[model samples]
Target: MCAKNILWIMCDQLRFDYLSCAGHPYLQTPNIDALANRGVRFSRAYVQSPICGPSRMSFYTGRYVRSHGSTWNGVPLRVGEPTLGDHLSEIGVRTALIGKTHMRADTEGMARLGIDPESLIGVQVAQCGFEPYERDDGLHPDGPYAPDPAYDDYLRDRGFGGSNPWEQWANSAQGEDGDILSGWLLAHADKPARVPEAHSETAYMTNRAMAFIREAKADGRPWCAHLSYIKPHWPYIVPAPYHDMYGANQVVPVVRSGREKENPHPLYASYMEERFSRVFARPGVRERVIPAYMGLIRQIDDHVGRLAAFLEEEGLTDSTMIVFTSDHGDYLGDHWLGEKELFHEVSVKIPLIVVDPSRDADATRGTVTDALVEAIDLAPTFLDAFGGKAKPHVLEGRSLLPLLRGSPDWTRRAVISEYDYSQRRARVDHDVPVADCRMTMVFDGRWKLVHVEGMRPMLYDLESDPEEFVDLGDDPACEAERARLLGLMFAWARNPANRITMSEEQIAAAYDTELDANILIGYWDEAEVDAARKARGDAE
Candidate 1:
């Protein structure tokens, strides 16, 4: 089969189970669900790392956190690294990215771990070889307060009074876009949608991407466009119509309460409490918040419908390889966490749909695979589809083209996700670093093992406790299972030699000793640093 145009639609912090195709009872993701019905859905898709930047970076590089050395955000992707876009672009595939490239940020807490700050935002989308046709730098749909006087007046019209810039504009309750930060305050009371057409971040980006797609089609180039939307991520915000779409009473609450003590990781319960309670800190808040989040999903679906319609309208449906997924899953109310960067299923699992135009409609269509796949597989998959090859480096992923073509034996037994925060903390109490933490995980088909550097590890039997309520790490009955998982962890640690040992000095030298120790890092800058570090090679 000839290589086809690739369109990867990625949503921010969306849980896999939130889609109707994935058995969600309330979500109205018809477009995504339809794609699932027409193509293949991998039920157990996971990211190489739980965090946003690292996972996205891994997806582009087809490498693990250890291989690419982009364990966190803010680290820059080195210039020469052969990313999916780089490979495809070099070999005649035109690539373009619009919307959120969380690939730009780095993990926040690297300073305390003695990791270089510049290395934090290692590999970014720009380095991955996409020409920046349009970029937002991850700004919200609700514009910042100071920039537009009209927006400031709009905020004042909505009676917003927060000193925080993000706080003032983020509330969806304050405006017609009541699902956002400012709109929330004014949602029921003021009804702020009077002025502008609720410019949804998700919808706007989708429209922009549609325009780009049209242009790409007219340009007559085999294109690869990535549209990464930034919601259902935080401060769960949708527009007027979407915010009211799903009923709170009907929305399933994340099953908590009884599961805390089961596989208790350090600060797990506390983290959940903080995550869930913060949104509802206001009285009767979740009733307003939860529905809006579902609304965002619906909104995403609505725009995706636009793309799907365009695909058919342009007669490109059978010629484009459309893929939909997320950087990671939002806990929503699961374990009370709203954002991602965790080991739990709700935080790690993502909805993945790949529609290969070349496959037989009945053979590769609407099929669901229960394989344990990782985001890293994306790079190799695109490489194969685009007539490129995976780098000879020790990559931890395999291509999915064979599975897309219905290969009977194509499956992954397990997958690994790594995270290293070690820096950003809530606050220092009793002289202990509040936020310093490092974690690694291994999840085979039925069992999962989470290893925290300074805390007791967590082991869960996913079959028996799908919600991950039981921590059977110390349970005598589970000793053999724990030992088995421990062995898996050891194997993962050993598979990548460079990650196993490296002094601070060594890492610094590998980075050309350019990274400073003081900067508060994020994923974008980390990519820049990591790209430089990788280029250093064995010179250090």
Candidate 2:
């Protein structure tokens, strides 16, 4: 079959279990559910890092957080790291970014390399290798950080006048007394945003994606369009009809337990005491905020349906692969945590649905697999779809094409994720040195172990305590399991991931080729070298 176009849709801060197809109780997401029915849904997909920037870097580079070295938000992805666009573009596919990536350019690295930021090559490098159609990270606050001027201009042309229209009209809600309530505050989450449904961030992003696809079709090139939505994130308010669609009664039950706060891990305790966590853990907080979160998701679902219809109308449905996923998930008060810094399933686990249009994927269609998949796998998956072999020396993730084609040999013993908390308040409260403010998690389908630097490692027996309500970090009974998981984590760390300059085949061939090139290090004499040559039939 010929290579097909790719439509990569990623949502910000969307949970794994919030979709109707994922068994969510009341959240009706028919459009996303349709994609799940037409594709393979990975039930146990995890992100490389629970945080946005690092997790997205993993998705773009097909490498781990540590491998990419962009450990947190605002950390620049090093200039030379090959990205998904770089890989796909090499094979003549048009790669474009229409929304959020949270990518910070490595300006210092670029200066050191003498690459001008405004140059054509440098612009591509700064954008993590994609040709940016409209790059907006979507956190357009008024002060300190510059607002997204493009979005602001669009809103102004439509008559929303303000110094910061995004924060004023789009993200704020109207109070009963005719006051503006900022959506950044959780109390205003129940109110509808001032912007109309058609001009909200989610809708605007979907329109931009459709526009990119139209231009790509006109140009007659196979394209990989990354349509990233910046919704269902914080400042959790949706516009118009969506905000009122769900109420406190529709909110799912919070997944936290009081026992978790009793003598919790020092790191976990610090996170629980954080402002966001404490506020979300309040008696009626989830009921107030989650409905709005769900509403944002519902808006996204509607837009997905619209985009799908557009594809069918354009006669591109059969020639495009749709990948629906998220960078990471929101805790929504799970484990007494509000944000996604921990390795709990609610925070690290995300939804992944792949609708490959190829006939070879028919067997796995409409099926759900419990395979341990990572966010990094997507970069290589896109590459494989474009008729490119994964460059194993650079791309750490294995291609999922084999599994999509019904190959049963795809099995993984453990999946790993990392977190760097050097910039978080938890590190400061715990007095952890910058070098030691890190953690790694290893999950082997049954047991989950988190190794925190310079602290007791947390362990969970998912088979017995699937909710992860109890931690066995200090429990003497689980020493063996902890040790085994540590060994696996250590083995994974010991891998020479930076040795990317040579392929495995080149390394194997170097053994004999070096001697043939007269760079013999262990040769005893000319006669010994002659014997070796004759043994290899080189003298014949």
Candidate 3:
């Protein structure tokens, strides 16, 4: 039989709890719900890192950020790293990327990191293995302000002028919302530009992906396509039909009473709550934002629905495998944060679903598995499906096919996530440079240990405190368990060698410099030096 077509859909900055299938009542994710009903849902799948680049690096390389070295947004993915696309393409599968590929930021860090000035107009695409057909060069949320130059002239008419542009705009009543005149006009209920354009971001992405699928199908070859959507990432703006999905009152807020003293990260105490509160503060904002987010989700769900419908219509549904997940998650008023990269449940835990259409009735379908899976496992899983062996070069992930087959011994006790030194540095004051520090997290089924800054570590008993507002790291009683977790962490760090061999480009760029130093100082260099000296003495 021909290899099955693979479709991987990645939603940017999406919280796991926002799905109706995930028990979110206010969010309407009917398409996702339907997908879940037809497949298996991983209830405890977590991203390897909470940030965009690291998590995506984990996804494509099947290695943790520390091992892959694409830890920060600006850093490139070592060009030669064996990616899902590289492997799949090698085995007769055409791979295509569409929309919001944040995996690597080349060319002055513009295309992948969303930092280019042209990005303001939405035209920035084409990095991270994608070829874009249409790109939205101007879709920011704090947008869509009045277009009439007379409006500003009216402000001038009303005797409102200041020293600076923002100061002039924020003249007591007006604000610094990012929306310009064209965007503002579009935001109006009765505007022509509000109509969905053939080149709007979502529509363009969906259209191109469909075209790619059709072409690949016609070529009679298997294909792997990554349809990544930039919705709901930030500047939280959704187009119409999505804009009015819910009432503000109906949007549920993350519930946390008094702040706890457990987490010592500066962001935990100072910034998190304020961000959440700000989003919730605006009148009807929740209703506006939640439904917008849901609508955007539904929009993607619509794409998924269309793709699925096409598969079935073309007699390919049963011959394709569909995997849906996200790169980390958004704050969306949960814990009062907005964008992700935090260690909170809403930020780190993502929705992971896998549908194997060729599975037997007895195979795991519509099942919710609790195995501690991480994004790194995805590459190996895809490779496994294509009759490829997962080479062990620096790949710390395991295949899920055995788990899917219900092998009794197939179990992963823990999954690990490591933050880059740069992001951890962002958490503290400049005076306390965290460059020398590395954080490693290990979570078993019920317990989590966070070793940060080489200081006293943190332990959370999720069974007791699901919110993770309390840290049990200081408890003397949990010492044995703590030691065991530490042992596991050290063992992972001490892994002699991993297999998924890298290309020369990847080896130089993605290899963790810091981790390599530790290994050289503590492991390989001493043995090599001794061998060299002994050879010299023997010659003498």
Top TM-score hit: 2
User: lDDT by residue for model 1 over 315-400, one digit each (tens)?
Assistant: 88888888999989866555655456778888888889998887543597888988889998887787777767554343457888
Q: How many residue pairs clash in each candidate?
A: 79, 0, 22
Clashes of 3: 22
Q: Write the per-residue lDDT of candidate 2 for residues 1-540, one digit (tens) a residue.
A: 545799999999999999999999999999999999999999999999999899999999999988999998888899899999888989999999988888888989999999999998899999989998988776665422224547778899999878778888889998889788999999889889999989888888889999999999999989999998888888898898988899899887778788898899999999988898889888998999999999999999999999999999999999999999999999998898897889999999999999989999999999999999888888888888889866888898888888787999998888989999998788899899998999999999889999999999999998999999999998999999999999999999999479877888889977667666778779999999888888878555
- List per-prediction Cα lDDT, in the order shown: 0.68, 0.89, 0.64
Clash pairs, candidate 2, are none
Candidate 1 similarity to native, TM-score: 0.78
Give a tens-digit lDDT track for model 3, residues 1-540.
223788888888888887888998777777777778888888999998887767887887777777767777657665445566666666776667765555543444443444553452222222343333322212222222111222233234445443322112311112247333232211231111232423335555677678778877898887777877665564344455655655556667654544543455543444444545455544555454565566667677777787788778778888777889999887665555556665667878999988866555236777788888889888878777767756656456777776665666767778788776544423454333646445678988788998876457778888998987777777899999899999988887886344455644666786645443444444457778577556756876
Rank candidates by TM-score, best first: 2, 1, 3
In model 1, the Cα lDDT at residue 262 comes to 54
**Worst window of 10 by summed lDDT in candidate 3:** 165-174
